[model samples]
Target: MEAMLEHHDGIALFTICRPEKRNAINFAVMGALEEAMEQAAADPQVKVFAITGAGSEAFCSGGDLSEFGHLRGTEARQMLMRMGELLYRLLTFPKPTAALVNGTAMGGGCELATACDFRFAKEGSRIGFVQGRLGITTGWGGASMLFAKLPYGRALDVLLRAEPMTAEAMEACGWVDAILPAEHWHEQWRERLAPYAERSLSVLQAYKAAAGEKWRTAWFREQFFAEIARCAELWGSAEHEQALRPFLCKK
Candidate 1:
């Protein structure tokens, strides 16, 4: 399975399972994530929704270029919008959501983390919104979500730098809620989530709805889609193509 969903102790843990590819997102992973979100959202027993990657090497490396690099123009826009929609769903999910950053996260991976209500990164892990390096802005509505979730200057710093930041640095910047020990991070996150998970599902949903009111607005949706469109335009640019070549070749 490219992804798997496990329900335990009132938490729905959606794991991206392609560790060999550094847990990159592909169509299969996207489909699995969507199904998992739907399933978890409808299940009364699930009080919290969380996402993570399979191994400690990476939480996610973003979209798999090996699979998606061939897309251009309208095809690129369609693909970008698909994940944009998913992240928007996550941003407005009725239940509390968390991103368990077990390892490094880059580009779309950072976008995925931004969509969550909380982020828990393991010690020594790093995160970067490095899509600029590829000549594209955040393609999946992450930049919009980041602006909503964080202060303007902080969010701008993350995007403008386009380089990895340590978990400690991210926590200081308010991007990460907590930094867990590298060992037993799974247990640590579970413990951190326990209080929220112990709450009634309805209560959790109510709080989430209230906290995410801005995200549910049509105005926010417009901005989100607009960001996706901008990134799609960049996706077809010559600079992005040039930058992608060396990265793919090295891979």
Candidate 2:
């Protein structure tokens, strides 16, 4: 499968397997991810869940905007909702979600990691909210989560400047929980999950759900939709279209 979904010892793992695309997420990838999350939720044996990219180049580049060029009206709306729903699913998930950010994380990649309770980054990886470069805010609730996690100035610097920061820089800003050597990132992550695996799955789920209470309310979803609607309007504007032009020209 282009998207990898597998379970191991009460720890369901999701991997974005399309390294050739820099682990960029397509609609298919989104669907697979949603399915995986649901599976993890349903499995009594699962406690802590983790997601990451297959390779070192990228965690995810974001939506396939080539597809965006073709979408209009309802299709565009559906895309927005799908992206938000998937982010919501991850954010409100009952289990403690972890993101093994093994490489460069930008745009939607940042959103994915932001949804998790812990982001375990690989050393040398970088992270950014690149949506500003395309004249949009974060497509998911990343901005809100970022503000919750970062000092105000740091959050403002990332959201407003749209600058990419090295994994170390991101850690300095409080974006990542831990950064490990790329050569042994997987091993270290497995070790981290070991303690989680030993914990009672039910207790883990209960505590995780409690932690997500503020972040995953109906009111929050409403706010998120309003924010993304603004983004859609921006995406349809000349300035944003102009910004996205270069990505279209990439061969």
Candidate 3:
């Protein structure tokens, strides 16, 4: 499986397992992730959900363009909608979600981490919203979510610049909640999240529910979907198509 899920105590860990592809997301990985998330949601014993990538080289580089680059127009729009739905699920999930950014998280990978309630990265990890270089914008509702989590100017800078920043830099900007040293990062994350895992499921759900009240409204949904539509329109553009080919070839 390109994605794998493991459950221990009250924590569910989802790992993107394709290190050779820099843990990029493809249809199979998305499907596996959805299933894992569904399982985690339905299981009363699961109190905290966590996500990470398999290897140290990258948490996730981004979408697997080799698989998705051929899509155009409506097809690309549908792809954006699909990813949006998954990210929305994560963003408003009833349980606390943590992203273990063990390495680099670029483009959609950064979006995935953004959707989580907490983001903890290894000290040397890098992250970015590098879609500009690919002739696209953040398609999975990342810009809106990022703005909600960070200062408006910083969010704008990150999106407009489309540059990779160190985890330390991002934490300073209030995007990354925590930055851990490379060695024993996983152990440290466990210690940090363990307390939450021990809490009752009902308590965790209630707290998340209260915090997510604003996001549960229709306005946020509409705005998120609108962004997806906008990105899809750009996905079929000549600039996007031209940039995509070279990026995939280099990968």
**lDDT per model, in order?**
0.93, 0.82, 0.91
Error of 3 at 96 (Å): 0.3
Question: Could you tell me the TM-score of candidate 3?
Answer: 0.98
| Candidate 1 lDDT over residue span 130-160, tens digit each | 9988999999999998888789999999999
lDDT of 2: 0.82
126-174 in candidate 2: lDDT tens per residue?
Answer: 8889899887787666776777668989888989889788888888888
The number of the candidate with the highest lDDT is 1
Work out candidate 1's RMSD over C-alphas.
0.9
Residue pairs in collision within model 3: none
By TM-score, rank the candidates, best first.
1, 3, 2
lDDT of 2 at 72: 56
- In candidate 2, which residue ranges exceed 4 Å CA deviation? none
Better model by TM-score: candidate 1 vs candidate 2: 1
Error of 2 at 106 (Å): 0.9
Model 3 ranges off by over 4 Å: none
Candidate 2 TM-score over all chains jointly: 0.95
Query: Where is the poorest 10-residue window by lDDT in model 1?
Result: 242-251
- The reply for model 1, stretches above 4 Å from the true place, is none
